[model samples]
Target: MLDAVVVGAGISGIYQLYRLRQAGLSVQLCEAGDGVGGTWFWNRYPGARFDSESYTYGYFFSRELLDEWSWSEEFAGQPETERYLNHVVDRFDLRRDIRLGARVSAAVYDDAAAAWTVTVENGERLRARFLVTAVGPLSEPYVPAIPGLAGFAGVWHHTARWPREPVDLRGKRVAVIGTGSSGVQVIPHIAAEAAELVVFQRTANWCTPINNRPITPERMREIRRTARTIHRTCQETPGGFVHRPLSVSALEVGEEERRERFQRLYDAPGLTMVLANYRDITTDRAANAAVTDFLRGKIRERVKDPEVAERLIPTDHTFGMKRPPLEDGFYEVFAQEHVSLVSLAEEPILRFTPAGIQTAARHYEIDVAVLATGFDAVTGAIRRIDIRGRDGVRLDRHWEAGPRTHLGLQSAGFPNLFFVGGPQSTTGNIPRATEIQVDWVMDCLRHMADHGHRYVETTPAAEEAWLAHVESTVRGTVLEDATSWAFGSNVPGKPRVYQLYAGGIPQYRARCAEAVEAGYTGFVFG
Candidate 1:
């Protein structure tokens, strides 16, 4: 039996393995895909890139690794991101312990033995003292139950499960669905090549232009020189990134000054315009409208047709509430002669014909349909495995109402099991969040070892309090107003409750620190 078994060979799992080995534990990782890079590995869709700057989006544990590997772009694309992860795996020599193309089917705790027996799809059973699920929050791809989808003779693909070889869209008619981050990014690229591109948007999304540019060698040198400072900045911020600090609320600024500030952020790169520029963009309605109006104006200005522009404007939710997507020429892409925008809200898709999709309004013939529909988010991947805890209590039944996680790290009934960057945690910059959770798990394990304890799990009472705390943190925020994936609202029949801890990363870190100082107050060890 191994000391620990980790599920999912993404960045989180990679770090978990690295740290576990450092602690002199025997650990093994199983991945569903054929390689490392978890989400990046599966999501090879065109135009997929990090919203956060490349420098701020990587692992923070190794300075040597940081100094050695270099990024080619400020906002790295999927290919580059995959390359970086592959580099990390090679640099750390982490492949020997990782079993690729092995998807975990079930993990059941042996209460008497105080261990877990994990079963994979390949009929392999592995026993471990502790099971750590590093399976990504956005790992599960969601395909909507559209009627007659199987009837479509044309090729269809989900963004999450895009083929390794590029799909040839040039001179081909393509239909794209969903206007979330991935859809927004993919549309522009598709519009560039597709002979006729039709976009099916269920809801319009808030999008800001990305100031994407190449990272020069000189810039790399400067980053290396002040690498410590950059890493420190990441730690100090709420999100694990360095960007514009909005000291005053949006209402505090004068009209001209507000426009100027918005303009400056709009001109700048990454998430500055929506997430970092205004303090009250997500909190206060009036402030959010101010930013919303500016973004809507930008969209209207870019797209030539007023009706099309209005169709693209999102009025249902507050700005920055639904995860705002950063884009390049996304708004402008609609103006292309070959492009057409199909509003699903206006005309719901009835079914798919043998040749194409048939909406209530009309049917459009297309060679390929790409479903950029988002994932099942945090809880989906975990529930995919038949995880049974105390007395064989199913994880699905436990989370049937919604996910209940103490600090998003452990469930109440599951002993000797842990989750890294799981649901109900402050899930911002993923690598940073992963580092925090992995470090905490290591600390908890060490504490258990030092105390001669064998079992650890969150108490029901503690789990309840944490869930309450999560609700309180996100109660009045814009995140609560939307039917977005943030609230598990994207997938039909999924619970409408807020599943993510909306509290800032810094605050979450402080709370985690307090728990450690107070003997991991939310958890119980035996």
Candidate 2:
């Protein structure tokens, strides 16, 4: 049996495999995709780019790797991001151990042998002492159950599963559904090409400007010089970004000063508008409302039509409640003559007809359709795989109410199984968060090896305590009130539970450190 088997060759999986192999352990990685890069590889839609600064989103473990790769833009596009991941894989020679096109169908734990037998879709099975699921939280694409999709004559594609080949939308009548992050990004590019473009939005989201620009040679040099400092800032901040919120609350500031600060952030690059905003904007009702009003005003100013502008503005939730996408001229796209906005809430979609979508009010004729509907999120990817632990307990059934785990790492009754970037994990700057998780898992594995333990799992009491801590941490935050994918609200019938650990990165790290100090408390190894 191998020492470990890691599923999904994404950022987390790649790093995990590298760390495990470096420790002289027999480790193998399995990727479902034909190629590596996981999220970047599959999400090849137009205008897909980094919201986080390119530097902060990449691996910080190697100074050599950081010095070699130079990003072209402050926020690199999908192509560049995919290439960067491929570069990392090649640089580390990680491909030989990674089996491409090997989708994991089931992982069953053998209590007697103290090993996990992982079955791939291709009838291949691998037994390992430990199993690490690096399958990303957002890996499973979620397409809404709209009737007559199969009967429609026009071609339809989910944004997550966009074809590798370039899609020709030139002069074609197109309909784009859902206005989440991907929708906002791809809609602008589609509008520029399609003869008639219709955007179907169920709920309007808070979007700020990306303001992406090419990185000059001078800036690249400066970035390389301050690479350590940049990574340090990400480590120190709450959201794992270089952007830090102000110390004072928005309620503490004057209206004039607050509006001015909001405007500056509006014009600034990346997610600074939200991540670097007032301290209380995400917590205090009045502070969140003030920032929300400012953003609504900006949206109104950009869109020429008053009705369309009003449709674009979100009314239900606060500004930072849902994860906001950084956009480039997104609101301005509606100003174009050929581009139209269809509010799904006002006129719900009846079904997909032969020509296009038929709503309650009217039918939209289109040649092509694009679904930007998001993912099942945190627990979806792992739950899809048939995972059986002790006593043939099903993972999906165990998490039917919601995910139960200790620090999002391991669940009770699931021996030798670990999760990185899974449910109850950190929220922002995914790569940075996953890096921290991977390091901790490696440490835990080392601990097991040194102690000559073959099986390990979290205690039921520990898992319950961690779940309680997660709930308590997000109890009063704005996130608890919002009905978004962050809380698993987008998927119908899915448990509406807070999916991520709302605690800051520093606190999470400290908690892990405490576990180590207490001899890996709440975990049993035999």
lDDT per prediction? 0.88, 0.92
What would the TM-scores of all predictions be?
A: 0.98, 0.99
Model 2: per-residue lDDT, tens digit, 1-526? 8989999988889899889888888988999999988899889999999999898898988889988999999999999999999999999888889999999999999999999999999999999999999999888999999999999998899999999999999999999999999999999999989999999999999999999999988898999999999998998888899999999999998999999999999889999988899998988888988999999898989999999999999877779898898899899999899999999889999999999999999999999999999999999999999999999999999999999999889999999999998999867888888888899998888888888998889999998999999998787888879999988999999989999988978788888889989998988999
What TM-score should be assigned to candidate 1?
0.98
Q: For model 1, what is the alpha-carbon lDDT of residue 472? A: 92
User: The CA-based lDDT of model 2 is what?
Assistant: 0.92
TM-score for predicted model 2 compared with the true structure: 0.99
Q: Which residue ranges in model 2 land beyond 4 Å of their true spot?
A: none
Worst 10 residues of 1 by lDDT: 236-245
- The digit string of per-residue lDDT tens for model 1 on 12-102 reads 8999999998899998899999989998999998899999888888876888998898899999999999999989888888888899999
Highest lDDT: which candidate? 2
The C-alpha RMSD in Å for every predicted model, in order, reads 1.1, 0.8
